[model samples]
Target: MQTEKVVNYIVHWLKDYATQARVNGFVIGISGGIDSAVTSTLCAKTGLDVLCIEMPIHQAESHVTRAQEHIKQLKEKFDTVSDTRSDLTPVFEAFKNEVFFDGDQATVDMALANTRARLRMTTLYYYAGLYKLLVAGTGNKVEDFGVGFYTKYGDGGVDLSPIADLVKSEVYELGDFLKVPESIMNAAPSDGLFGDARSDEDQIGASYPELEWAMKMDEAGKRAEDFTGREQIAFNIYKRFNTANKHKMIPIPICEIPSNLL
Candidate 1:
């Protein structure tokens, strides 16, 4: 995709949405990942008030540092850009100790990670409400739609999704065009939820390039058998994630009564 065209589209989309909603600006959680960096930059380009919040829950120091750097760069370019950091380690620890202390280790680990995401979501909304700003989402197409690799009512909850249509590769392309800091652009994509800082590919069992290809093939009605060995394995993994997380990608199902029963 043409970087300039995509940037222009997102900037105009944000401006138009804010005008329609009569909101003052946007509030986005900066995760130091390419997705957030790109989204924050697009929001800042609108010249409206944009708050880049760093909500870290026992996050890696490197992640925090990169986020700060990105925010600093944003401030240099857009006077409307502002930033604040919220450490959520205490709250997360409390939840784990009070709620999931006796749970299975695997289950507890997953719960704790999800809690971190939800906490960040809460923090973003808190600032959004206080400043009359919309919560801008940073999820991309492959993660948000193809695999549903996001927390429901957590990272998935947002007032606006500026880059939801772009794939992971497309996001990196935009990041390069926007001149995002090399530290952030080059870093492995992680949710920053786990303590060990496992990359998204590590957690998901497939690289983004593989997943993106699988998604495109699936969209074109291709089956796993079309490929052999490793490629098939990747496609199967993609299908499994998509199936398991379908609920996160769609609206809640509702029961309907027959028309004659009205």
Candidate 2:
């Protein structure tokens, strides 16, 4: 892809969309991941007010450091860029106290992790409403469309997605062109929802590159039987996520009323 052209296109798209919507600018959660770094940079290039928020809930040190580094770089590079930090650890703990823990350990843990994402989403939207800024999504093609690896109405909740069309590799290319912090470019991709340093691959059981390959295969109508060994395992992993998380990828289903009934 023409990296420069792609960057310009996204910047223009963002500016145009915000202009049409009459929003002042954008607000995004900075997770220190490649997707957020690239996305925040793209928004900064739009020459509109961009707020980078850090909402951490038991987040790992490395992730926090990288997020801070990236935001600092963005503020230095773009006059319209600004940042704020909100420690959601206490809020998460309070929420856990109010909720029941009747489920198994793994199940409860998963739900709580998703809660972290939802909290951050709420935080971003709060700022967006206060500042009249649009909530900019940081999801990429593989995570947003291919694997559906995001929390519904959580991180998936956004006013617009600037990088959803670009795959992980393509996002990295944009990151390079945008001069994102080196620490982020070298860091492992993660959701940071679990409050640990475990990478996204560790949770999904497949790396971005592997998932990207599997996504292409599935789109080309290839089945698991077509591959063997590691390839088959990766393909199956991709399919399982794509199928289970399909709800996040599509619009919510609605019951249509029959016109005759009225």
Candidate 3:
């Protein structure tokens, strides 16, 4: 896909959505990642007011620095781009101290990480409400649909998802065309949720390229048994992730009654 065309399409889509919804602009959580960087740049390109919030809670210093740099570049390019830095560490610590309970360390850790995402979501909505802006999401196709990698009701909660159809590699392509900072473009992709700074690959057990390939193969009705070595491993990982996170990707299930009864 041509980056320029994709950029133009998303910008126009955002404009149309906001205008029809009677919203002033977009509010996005700038996570210092390529997805957020690309999404924010696209939002700014719409020439509408954009509030890029950097809500850091025990975030990696490198992530924070990259986020600041990206926002600075955005402000320089677009007058409509404005930003706010929110320190959410105290908020997270208070929640942990007051709400967390003893359990499996891994489970507790995952919950805390999710809490961080939810906090960021809340902060975005708070600004959205105050400014009458829609909360723009930054998730891409691979993470959002291929593996359902986002936190449910956390990062997954948003008024709109602009790049949910593009794959991870395609996001990088868009980022390059948008002239996102090289520092962010070259950095490893991390959710910045675990506090230990683990890359998404470290948690997902497969790189974006591998995952993308796996998704393609699966969609084409290829079986893991037909592949060997790393291909097989990638297929297996993809299947496991997609199955485990299907609940997150699919809509809520509801019971239906027979119309005759009514």
lDDT of 2 by residue, 106-144 (tens): 999999998999999999999999999999999999999
lDDT of 3: 0.94
Index of the highest-TM-score prediction = 2
Task: Please give the CA lDDT of all the candidate structures.
Answer: 0.92, 0.94, 0.94
- Across 112-205, the per-residue lDDT of candidate 1 in tens digits comes to 7888889989999999999999999999999999999999989999998999999999999999999999999889999998865689999999
lDDT of 3 by residue, 127-192 (tens): 999999999999999999999999999999999999999999999999999999999999999999
What would the TM-scores of all predictions be?
0.96, 0.98, 0.97
After superposition, the stretches of candidate 3 with alpha carbons farther than 4 Å from their true spots are: 258-262
* lDDT over C-alpha atoms for residue 69 of model 1: 93
For model 1, the superposed segments whose C-alpha errors exceed 4 Å read 257-262
User: After TM-score superposition, what is the CA distance of residue 162 in candidate 3 from its true location, in Å?
Assistant: 0.9
Worst ten-residue run, lDDT, model 1? 94-103
